[model samples]
Target: MAEKNLLEAFLKAEELEIQGKEFYLDASEKAHIPSVKDLFKQLAEAEEFHRIKIREIYQTFQAKKNIPAYVTKISQKQISPVFDPKEIEKVASVVTDLAALEEALRLEEKSIQYYQSLSDKSKDLKVKRFLLALIQEEWGHYLSIFDTMEFLRDPSSWYTFKEHWGLEGV
Candidate 1:
């Protein structure tokens, strides 16, 4: 049935959120740099929020019930890894900080694409709106990661604009 399909879609999205959270949490734990560690923790928190939201949506539609009043909660949980910790560790060990940030950026971009496709497929107004909101949220995640990536790639260039140095390359 179409409703079953929608539920499955949400469940898949929820799985991605969990995986993302787990990846970021592990990355934060492994990172030595203070700023990178903090960024990863923040990203993990956002992914957990998305996981809860997607689960709420799945429950609402699965039971043919209305959307519940939502509240944001920040809690840590142990989720099964979708990506191996060793793999992330390898990247951390071998790659630059920009590479790790790029990985997060890629994940956010992929999530946005998935949400956009889901929104386009949805015929119901509520389903469409829900997916649209998710897309917007994912965009915000992408932008944050991108900004961090830019800063990490070139600290002087990134801060020069705000510092009003009027230098092309700082």
Candidate 2:
């Protein structure tokens, strides 16, 4: 019964990753800004990686009837801040960009919540750890999208706050 549940969770996770990858790919193609496009591409790659890893784990679990020990080592790529403060002026207030960012944020949040719930229900420590790792990656994606939204809304304020530059002198 537990194995069935685990397998179901794995299938759901893979599906979510696939959806995220497709959305990001489309968003990347539609993005006008180079930085935004690159960021979306990076996200799409990460989602693809997660989908692959989930499939591998699912196959291993089916054959072995247990979570793999190496599952803990599965990690997503760490994405650095892509938006440059200098390029802030170049980022026009495009409604589609903001709308896409909002949608991306929603997708990431859903993934995080799903993983967290799955982790809580998991009995195996390795499976729990794997879900936790996925949750963290989704959170990273969420934060990246959120930061991009903030930058789009008000680049100067976002840059000032992100860079920790004092505004007292002004």
- Candidate with best lDDT: 2
TM-score winner: 2
Query: Per-residue alpha-carbon lDDT of model 1 for 41-140, expressed as tens digits?
Result: 8889888888987888898887899765432322334221122223333333424556677887888888888888888888877777777877777777
Segments of candidate 1 deviating more than 4 angstroms: 68-94, 167-170
User: Considering summed lDDT, which 10 consecutive residues are worst modelled in model 2?
Assistant: 67-76
Q: What global local distance difference test value does model 2 have?
A: 0.84
Reference-based TM-score, model 2: 0.90
Candidate 2 C-alpha error for residue 46, in Å: 0.3
Misplaced by over 4 Å in model 2 are 70-73, 167-170
Worst 10 residues of 1 by lDDT: 78-87
Task: Give the local distance difference test score of model 1.
Answer: 0.71
